[model samples]
Target chain A: MKRALTKRIVIDGVLTAMALAIWVVEAQIPLPLPVPGIKLGLANVVTLFAMFALGPLDAGVILLVRIGLGSVFGGGLTAFLFSLAGGALCYLLCLLLRLVVKDKQIWVLGALGAIAHNAAQIGVAIALTRTTGLVVYLPVLVAAGVITGTLTGLAAQASYLALKRTTLLSRLKGGASLPKEPDDVAGEEDETEKKNQK
Target chain B: MKTWVWVVIVAVILAVSLTVGVVLLTRQPQGNVAYVYVDGELVYQVDLSKVDQPYLYTVNTPYGTNVLEIAKDSIRIADADCPHKECVEQGRLKGSPLVCLPHRLVVKIAEDDADSVSR
Candidate 1:
């Protein structure tokens, strides 16, 4: 039992590092548009994968660590607040989505998550600035969010499918021995079989 | 559900937002007053309709300084020390506000006395 706990921590730590790296690197790239709070949001791919494969709780830990560390590394207090609001909204949306979305439709979750994240960030921006004029950016932000969210969501779905069959994940599941069978993410081999038959 | 269903939903959302964005971006600003803000504090309010001559105003913030060009009917960032130059590129204010995130500077158009007066 102790071993499993240790393994889970190590994995979550590794994933958080991965997310932070992506966040920092992506920040360095010049945005194509002039809009603030708009980006590819590549770090969210890891968040979505962790949420789906490991669990929401695991994903939450990784997300919090990533946002906290990310702000220290590449942002300030204001940026941290924006990220926290955005990340929390995205995480909560994912938890709600898990109940309805099928494994094959993970991309939908990604798109919606992106939109929700952007909306929450904009809310923070409005509150901090105390300006209703910033609300004018909403339409553009919403459009951008849908596009970027779809990309990240598809990326997460692809990663989830690829990692599902890896011996590492199997070991994480059966070896660490969580007796894992959530109604949301069970029957992996069966899913593969169904895919193959189709 | 079919993957197409998700695609359709996203498509509809994208279409709607895009239309709204275009409308907002292209619409003319209705009011005469333009408010300048730095770090969320109101610094200056210019009544564009009242200005007979074009002028340049400089806003100095801890983050950086931005030069704004104010004209009879329009306001724009003429120059900025920020890296991206996005504020400068944003051109004149139409319906949307001009924002320089790095410098925490914003220029917004107000339509009525009440709008700028409330702050």
Candidate 2:
């Protein structure tokens, strides 16, 4: 019991590290928005992946670590405050949305997370700017969020699937491979996917 | 996948249409008016609608302070004992005056339809 819990703690720590690394890379890209508060929210894919690969608790930790490290690397005090407010709200929204979706198709949840993150950031910007005109940009930002989130979700889903095919995910899920093969799960997924393809 | 494509297409269309609408709706940009107050009294006013070409002018606030002007319409702080330069960005009345909020200084364009926001 203690051993399994320790393994989870370690895996979660590694996942958080991976999330921060991805965030650092994405920060280099300078995608401008018409308004001040919108961005692609690329790091969210890592959170969605972590949520499925591990659990929501692990995902939340990864998000906080990435946000903290990302802000420290690029932004100053004011940016940190804004990111904290926005990132916390985004994570909470994602957690709430996660209940509806199964682990297989978590991208929809990712889309919602992306939109929520932008909304939270815009809310913080409005508070600081005290300008209602800035609110007009929210719809456009939400629209942008949907695209980026979907892409991130697609990437995450692909990675999750690929990892599952190997012995790695099986070992992670259970200490040892079960007597009977768990190939049926993948087979079932493929059958449904084929129908969708048609 | 079909739904996703439609979503992206709609987002693109909406963003482009809204931006174009804002552009079409905006009237030609115009300069601002300059008002001066002294001893808590209305001392003078300058309607810059007729003023053309780049110019700057210096004026005093109620606090007996002199602000600087760079050109016909550009202004800056020649000198200000005020702790914050929030007003410094307000430079010249190309549109608005140097606004010192703590000092209650408003250097802004007075729109013709200031009452009506909708075009």
Candidate 3:
């Protein structure tokens, strides 16, 4: 049991490091859109993957760490607040959506989570700037969210599927035995394992 | 739910938002008055139509500095000290306001009303 606990902590640490790296790199790449509160949100791919593969608790820990550290390394207090709100909202939505969304439908979580993230960021922006006129950016932000969210979602879904086929994920999950087949039964077994972990 | 249902729903949302966003982007402002606010407080106002020659306007807030290029009937953020410089890249003011989120700076064009009060 202690070994399982240690392994879980190690895996969470690795995932958090991966997420922070992705976020810092993504920040370096300037987006073409001049609109504020819009980006590719590639780190979301890691969050989604962690949530679906390792369950909500691990995912939440990874997300919070990434957001907290990402802000500290780059943006200051205001950026920290914005990311906190957005990241919290996105995590909550994904947690709720996971029950209804199947393995292949992880992209739905990505798209919806992205929308929630952008909307929450805009809310923060409105309150900070005290400018209701900022609502004018909603439609554009939503459009950008949908496009970027789906892209990241698809990436996560592909990663999840590819990794599930190998023993890598099982090893990460503290050497818990995972079914090797890539079929509906294998998916069901994974779900049962997740339920047991919960 | 079927995968197709999710696809259709996302597609519809994308289409609607894109169309509305485009319309808003393409629409022209009805007035020549620009109001600049820092942390929700009105700091400056400019009558763009009255300016014959372009000039530079600078605003310094607790967050950073933003340099605006005010021209005849148009205003744009020429530069800013913010990390992304998104406000500067936003170019000219149209129907939408130029927002520098990090600095809490907002520049918006107001409607032309002969007797409108500025609060």
**What digit string (tens of lDDT, one per residue) describes model 3 on residues B1-119?**
98999999999999999899888877888888999999999999999999999999999988999999999998999999998888887889888889899999999998878686778
Cα deviation of A12, candidate 3, in Å: 1.3
Using TM-score, give the best candidate's number.
3
Residue-by-residue lDDT tens digits, candidate 1, B31-98: 88999998789999999989889999999988889999998988999999876576887788777788
Model 1 per-residue lDDT tens digits across residues A97-163: 8888888788888888988998888887777666767887888888988888888888788777777
TM-score of chain A of 3: 0.85
Question: Each prediction's DockQ?
Answer: 0.47, 0.07, 0.70
List where candidate 2 sits over 4 angstroms from the true fold: A173-198, B1-119
Q: What is candidate 2's lDDT per residue for A1-198, written digit by digit as tens? A: 565566566666666666666666765554543244345676676677777666678788887877788777865444566567767876787677667555555667666667777778767655643433345556666766667776787677766666667665655555444424446644543343233212
Q: Is the docking of candidate 1 incorrect, acceptable, medium or high quality?
A: acceptable
Cα lDDT of model 3 by residue, A93-171, tens digit? 9999999988889999889899889888889999999999887778887888898899889888887887788666776
Model 1 local distance difference test score: 0.80
Clashing pairs in 2: B54-B72, B54-B73, B55-B71, B55-B72, B55-B73, B56-B71, B56-B72, B75-B92, B97-B107
The Cα local distance difference test for each model comes to: 0.80, 0.57, 0.84
- In terms of lDDT, the poorest run of 10 residues in model 1 chain A is A189-198
Clashing pairs in 1: none
> Total backbone clashes of model 2?
9
